[model samples]
Target: MASSTYKRYHVHGYDPRQHLEHYASDKPDMAFEEDVLKFPMENLAKTFSLGHIRGDVLIDFSASCMIHHLYAACEFFNHIIVLKVSERCIMELKKWLDMRTGAFNWGHTLKLHREIQGIGDELPDKEEKMRSAIPHVMICDLEKENMTDPIVLPPADCIISVWLLDNVCKDQDDYIRYLRKCSRLLKPGGHLILLGGLGMTYYTVGKDRFHVFTYDEAFARKALAGEGFVIDDCKVKKRTAMCDLVDYKASIFIVAHKEK
Candidate 1:
């Protein structure tokens, strides 16, 4: 979706699938954040319990193709729902899931779609599965759809949106609004895991190059606090570029949880 609003403001600099050693930029030959350190999935599981999932409902916003977190959540939760505002992201996820149809359970993998409310209709059947076959993954985005739309969801037990809000938002105000939207999707005492380049300048995905809004950790913490979320625990780390091109400043990753 090309927008006149975004003239040369491309968000991604390289394709997520490509090797950073191949880039021509002057950035130190690090590695894509996704490929660098295996996201602390085990730690995430320890921090939040799917078994204690408040309302049998877990929602994710702007969950791009990164399904690792989702896969981890399904280990305990029953009904996992994902919403995606970007059709391209949705299609890409579907394609990835399709590849695993043989060993992976598509029906159990998730109910990925354009909206989060769709799960309400399938909650019954979803809860029936017992042996870790939970709806652990759902992706929702605010770009293609409005957060107020009935299709959007209320608060959920676990809410996560990584590398989403900063890239799509128009400015700081827009970013805050998007975070509030994320809060709205969770129940009062749910956990919201937010991760991305805190001021992630420019980077490559695989072959596509894009620019990040340079979101600030301090500002993000304040925004989350303003949204009634308690900074339960937050860890900030510098993200080094993997591409062989120009290495920009380091990026940050933050995690916040909604207060009861």
Candidate 2:
């Protein structure tokens, strides 16, 4: 999309309502499921299929409510890192993890094989080993320079950021820069997955306003390519259909892998 046209289409100074609270309490009705389902299962099975995740680390940035599902989906990974900037998110995941520790949250069915380690402090070897047996969750603010600051994370095999790019980038260039940083976090031949909130016009939380850009598949591909990510494969999924029945656009789901 042309920059001029893109700006014109987006409602200036739009703020999204804080839906995270609603999501934290209960899954608010949005098109996120539709978007996730839109991913071509065949391609996903090939790319993200458990067998492909050989890296020792899988970093999930701004993991929000996905910790539960991701834990179930990625069984092959030895270590799964869950990153989130929200305390509520951390609290919820911690609660879930805590329950699993004692007698297994929902019986022996909840397999606690992966560890969920928080960022910042150095964890003890024994603690790390135990946590690695369950999904690890950490509280981190990626937008802040001190913690995430782009230089803190280890070289990862796969870095996934969902519904977070639009919030960080002020414009297309900023978005591209964010993508470059994401690429840097991954090792050569690693992968990047971008998910959530694609076609939103504006979002508001409390008094905050979030400006959004409706990024299409081609636009996402171009942005990733500019960041040196060759499209190994891509599947577009709709995130939300908020407008009245007449006019609505699905959020775009993009999965782009970094190349050598």
Candidate 3:
């Protein structure tokens, strides 16, 4: 029998609405936010507060049409450039940024971020800050040497990538190659904050199942070190919730700096 073609997937095959319903809900289960979102945001906040990561231009390589992970970075960077792999993703993000009807509600995410940073009273101001910081949302092709070709972006002080590498890369070598490509967009010694799911091979969206590269903490460290990054913080939160939609064993968060 011929192999199933349903396994074949593309970035555009991803359903933004289903993704939001699954992961960006206002009151996601405890494990969803606590393990997946809070830990990463807290680590980012701690890094910035200690003066380890700062930059005028912050480039978001994994613009997955969600801003939940952006609140922390917005507090530190004045300019945020979001690069998406697919036009569908870009359109989803634009809806939110432009305040179009039926945009995914991120109020819960904003509230959680404020609580994490102890800036509950400054939510409005911070929201405005993020709005002003994110002025550009463009397309990128990770397979290309210049991810954002024909449009040379200024070297960023820091780059944030969340749940991007695993899905795009077919194997470990591709993962490392893409990492190098993204690293090139940052200034020397610039910080790289990575958020990823561990031991994840596939995640379901609506009726489609997409591939995710399987990896672990040790492999992640090795990859970063090989890419000339100095690992500053590595945190792993074991998976505590099980949903039929996604199969991930743990959540890995890393903060590293490119060392030339």
Give the lDDT ranking, best first.
3, 1, 2
Report the number of the highest-lDDT candidate: 3
lDDT of candidate 3 vs native?
0.80
Candidate 2, residues 175-255, lDDT tens digits: the string is 786677677778998878776455555544444434455566667878888888876655554434342311125544456
Reference-based TM-score of each model: 0.66, 0.64, 0.93
- Each model's lDDT comes to 0.52, 0.51, 0.80
Put down candidate 3 lDDT per residue, 1-260, tens digits, no spaces: 11223242345557776677777676545236666567777877777788767779999877357787888788788899999887888888888888799888888778788788887667677666787899899988776778788999999999999888877877889889988887888899898999999988777777777778889999999999999999988889888766767788988989999997
- Candidate 2: where are CA atoms >4 Å away? 1-32, 36-46, 100-136, 141-151, 203-210, 238-248
lDDT of 1 by residue, 1-260 (tens): 22333312223222222322242122344344332223434335445553444356666564244554554455445566766554555555555444444222333223321012233344443323422343333334354345545465545778767666755766788878878777767777787877666645544444344545666778888888888888766766554444543234444445566777
TM-score of 1: 0.66
Top TM-score prediction, candidate number: 3
**Candidate 1 residue 183 C-alpha distance from true site, Å:** 1.3
- Say what the RMSD of model 1 is: 9.3
Better of 2 and 3 by TM-score: 3
RMSD of each: 9.3, 9.1, 2.3
